[model samples]
Target: MDPLYDRLARELRECIVTGVYGAGERLPGVRTLSRTRGVSVATVLAAYRRLEDDVLIEARPRSGYYVRNRPTKAIPAPARSAPAAQPSPVTGQELVLSLVKASNDPAVVQFGAAVPDPSFLPVRTVERALARAARQHRNRAAAYAFPPGLPELRRQIARRMSAYGCATGADDVVITNGCQEALVLALRAVTRPGDVVAIESPTFYGLLQALDSLQLEALEIPTDPVDGLSLEALQLALERWPVRACIATPNFSNPLGYCMSESRKRRLLTLLGARGVPLIEDDIYGDLGFGPRRPPPCLALSEGTGAEVLYCASFSKTLSPGLRVGWLVPGHHQARVEYLKYVLNMASPTVPQLALADVLHSGGYERHLRTVRSDYARAVGRMIEAVTRHFPAGTRITQPAGGFVVWVELAPQVDSLRLAQLARAEGVSIAPGPIFSATQKYRNFMRLSCACPWHSDVETALARLGTLTANLSIG
Candidate 1:
């Protein structure tokens, strides 16, 4: 390499190593960088040219230069002569762990977590129920938790499922650590590595995480923001792929909050059942619909299918997320799910499950959800209106029937990751759109949580977000 070329390559490589250029990130144009750094355009071009030749950067026509794909830094090897520990069992699950951790950083505003407002939850009522359970099981609190969760709690879950038109008995229900674990158990019970599972596009990240851990391939079906998955697209996927299972959120799906129409629900179940595709319905947010009446769950809608829908739900969303109480109504796969649930973790927390049962039996949980639904509805309206008024023209937002999330579309020039960083500096947390995309296509979109108190400060925060959005360069 020429001397200048060598120097430029070294500098650019160092910048990339230090995250100045960053992974999957496009760098400023040569002319712009030259102007900022007071270097000759030729020198800047030479640097980029050398970097490209070295496979350290790539040029996209009309899109400027981007850092090339580089392997992540390997862990430093143990001291050269040290005894090598046996390599940890490799499961090919690193991607899932990385994505899940990225979502948990406290610095971010947490539009990513499908959590309801704590203020809206009946915390006091739950506390009281806990108190009652403590008194009732004072001596028992020292004992090991009941396997598969408390029997009465399972019975309570069964009663609620009855409202959805599924007359499932408590014996068929297996309580797990949370909805996530319930999903993992169902997946483990029905699927093995290399099995293709169908999922809605932009589906719940947790579900994706579970699938990734299982070493399963997810075939995404195009989903409508307002109507859940497209039946036609799903039919095509089913016909084209040998899918072992289908995992979906038919009511108030996370991120998008799309509810499948009852007619579509019936049709989808019929179609999947006909094709022998086992459906895993995540109804965690079912009871939190903003409207007065709740849509019957997909499991309820799949009543006559003789056991096709493996329904899973939890109070983690509507109640205390920390409680980590959830269940799986396995329908046709009941025995398998129950056995897997036992093998995986054995059971959920005994005290919390018992307390939740008491809370449900006493009707406080219903009242709490009613309050959450009303407040969340108002917050959703306020957010949608704010996005419309504050965002630039052509911005589109979802009007979900329930839940406190709104998906906003921005002009293509606005990269949400950059915007989220800017928003965080202003004491606001937001979920960037890329986190929800498997293919990372929604750089200009974001998901906002309306689960916070709609107070003056939050209102100002919303306006500030709008201002940031409006001032974004569309270059």
Candidate 2:
């Protein structure tokens, strides 16, 4: 039997989907809904919350809940990727740099950077926390914090990890500059230069940059657009190549934005455990899930199995990126990672850590997450709708379960690089797919960020991009 809240939510959702409740139409007040439906106010609220999480409705303080204007149609998600089955050198640094530069330009309509817009963030809350930290911990802020960061922050992280089933304590966490640094530490701790690392085909460009920096080769593995990394292909790659370590973003991967199932995560951990290979799991975007609960990390799945899953994550995606706060649990290799972190850079900034700790301790971070998650979910839906309306026939895209980026597979003749160049000239920035691959594949693919609010500017940019892609495809 379904819970009362679930039943209520389902009925309401059906009404909205069927157009019974028109877009922007206000829902009944909590008291009215409870009275009419013979349910408690809590149940009604829960139902409304579920709708908000689903990006179907929004709440306005002092007003009421209103149905969001969602697109009537959406594009079909792209098919599973079939990357080449050989190791390749990473060489997309220049292209990545250009994309980064263009993404940062204030004049451009940014669909390139996988960063949440400030409007969607808790800016005032963060500022208040920073000011309070500076005022209260002036001396601590003045000193350099070594390797393992603030005890309070680590405790907060560990406490949060328990929600995802990771039985970690403060001692297991090592703070770094960001998830990038944490990834570097994990990679350095596990493998040496010239070693081969297995990664998702349409992986994060940052991972490729890390591999390039360390002079490591990447063995591209086939990844599903919806299911995440393909275990069978990875197994084949493991059998064929002398892979040192496996790196993946199991929960809400960049570009692809697929979250591995719990069972698959367990299988992946077991596979790596049997091979004596460490799996570096990046969960930077794990908190941005639009579901009722956060997904479990691979480390959580590997718990008690003795699997060496180095869990890397950060508050950058959820909290404040400018703070550059990230942490990792390196399992058996904790000491080695700590030393590497010390050698790489004595420690992360003290003020930001303390400030973030205060924010987490205040119990406001969770509330902020709820708000941001809803915003991101809505933004992603809007982006999908825009693409469906604008893109030419045969264009395919990824309907991500979470995260703020969408991957689009254009016609074979369409060159995303040329499209990006054209988009930039028109004051728009986009991330070309070639940057996400080590072998420069995905030439007709592109990643679009849904981090910003929907507006005319974004709509215009997508239309322009569609036109450019159509022209390229025709030529």
Candidate 3:
């Protein structure tokens, strides 16, 4: 399909979704639209067909296309999440453990964990790369890859990061077990026990676990469903508290999935830079954006501004999660993170680094991203549509631009934890909202994974989950 048609289709979709064309309203004739938009008849037809495939519009034998009645049109977006206004010690989540256990059971529909299905990853490509690396680095395969990891792997990471607009070198990159360790290292490098770290409300539960282990305090800020972290609330928090670091997933964050705009990123840097607080960027989901260009990290937008941005990312989402190769660009805290990486685990495994570097250098990684990005985008849409149609009329959900998870806000009367237990009894698993917070603020919301391939089993599971949710709302 021509890129032009895709752009036109997107514009037409915005129109239908925004109610420019009301339910069942007819759209302009193909030729008329083609002339008005200054495009060929083929382009118009292609655009209309795209919307048709998305169920946004439909065609009649003799009439022009018409907008389909949208189930989500009347439902407002999820209310912005508001965690505690004060910083407090992080706490463990038992529901997270239960969700993880259910996620591993094949009999259960897997919507608990926010990980992509293995089928959507570059399994074969990485396996081949691993074989080649083992054959080539037979001696080094048994060795420990000391701090900062292999120069070759670091260099590959540095080069890939350059495209994201960060000025990095092999010395600036530090490899860890995965993004989990990267976050722990970044937190330890900049913060101490009882120090405050401002974060998004309804954040990734893994982050809460990291803070809990480090004995750090969390200052949760209200986050918008569309624009991401609210700078106003963060600035206020910084003024009131002695925040040591601010951790954020500015690009396609988990659960919420809002990608902060470039302007917001710049302003955030200036705000934190003024206060001398480091911004620990968890960009694990940065590469999974549905847009044409990969979303740049906060470090990229902070260049020349003299802001402190510690960027962390991993190949686990795009490649094999078990491979466990993640790198961090610690702008000024590079030395601290390196030392901690050595102390925490001595060193990351040698062969996986070499294997990942091989896959990246071969140009297969980017090709793999192109396929998986589309798959995630399509899956997310299907999940949102399903929730919108079958769930309660007032149920709200995030419309993520990227990533494969959707955060749902159910009716206030419903207890999400109870809903999860009910769903589990029917062989369906879901991550209830309370698990996402250290303070456990969102009792009625839940985050659902859309990374699974859409099938009858998955469809049936979501519908059944919706029925259960409705049952709870009634009682």
lDDT of 2 by residue, 408-441 (tens): 9999999999998999999999999899999888
Quote each prediction's TM-score: 0.76, 0.88, 0.87
C-alpha lDDT of all candidate models, in order: 0.73, 0.88, 0.87
What tens digits encode model 1's per-residue C-alpha lDDT throughout 68-99? Answer: 76535321211111111111112222333433
Give the distance in Å from residue 61's predicted Cα in candidate 3 to where it truly belongs. 16
Error of 3 at 437 (Å): 1.3
Model 3 lDDT, residue 289, Cα: 95
Which runs in model 2 stand beyond 4 Å of their true positions?
Answer: 1-74, 304-306
Worst ten in a row by lDDT for model 2:
69-78
Candidate number with the higher lDDT (2 or 3): 2
Ranking by lDDT: 2, 3, 1
Which one is best on TM-score? 2
State residue 443's C-alpha deviation in candidate 3, in Å. Answer: 0.4
For residues 1-475, write the lDDT of model 3, one tens digit per residue. Answer: 2279877987887686568889999999999998999999999999888777665678988988988766646456787877779998877576677777776788989998976788788778888989988998899998889988999999999999898788888899999899989999999998888899999998999999999988899999999989999999999999899999999999889889999999999999999988889999999999999988988888988865567988888988889888899988887788888889888899999989999999889888888887678768867887888898889878999989888899999999999989988999999889988888878888899999988866678878988999999999999
Candidate 3 ranges with C-alpha deviation above 4 Å: 1-74
Better of 1 and 3 by TM-score: 3
Error of 2 at 34 (Å): 18
Q: Give me the displacement of residue 311 in model 2, in angstroms.
A: 0.7
